[model samples]
Target: MGLNIGTITDACQWECVNTGTITDAYQWEFVNTGTITDAYQWEFVNTGTITDACQWEFVNTGHDL
Candidate 1:
């Protein structure tokens, strides 16, 4: 139903190649270092935090949030 991520360390790296839908509900934070590559639809509800040090590359051609 939802995803709850308490904290993300500085060493954390994420590579997401989504072709469908990625949905997250509630609060979360993406901090320090990371990479997010979204291709299709990505949806997020509620509030969240993203630090300036985190790298996000979204190649979304469709609907995204």
Candidate 2:
């Protein structure tokens, strides 16, 4: 249960595709709860599971204030 990008203004591209098997893997932050300051706007690609499946990922630059 992740992927909760709560604040991202424009220049956006989000994709989280899961096709089979995903119990729990919590570690997603591209502005997950609050505050965002210049982290290339927004770009996340969680291709199911914990990490790396189809590539295109970036979920941590600096924010939560």
The numbered model that scores best in TM-score is: 2
Number of residue pairs clashing in candidate 1, backbone atoms closer than 3 angstroms, sequence gap of 3 or more or interchain: 0
Please report the TM-score between candidate 2 and the true structure: 0.21
Pairs that clash in candidate 2: none
Query: Per-residue lDDT tens digits of candidate 1, residues 1-65?
Result: 11112222222353223333334322333222344333234323332333221333322234533
Model 2 residue 43 lDDT score? 42
Tens digits of per-residue lDDT for model 2, 1-65: 33544445432444344544654334433323345444333345455556543343555545443
Model 2: ten consecutive residues of lowest lDDT: 24-33
Candidate 2: where are CA atoms >4 Å away? 1-12, 26-58, 61-65
| Model 1: residues with Cα > 4 Å off, grouped in runs | 1-24, 35-41, 44-62
| TM-score against native, each model | 0.20, 0.21
- How close is each model in CA RMSD to the real structure? 13.2, 10.0
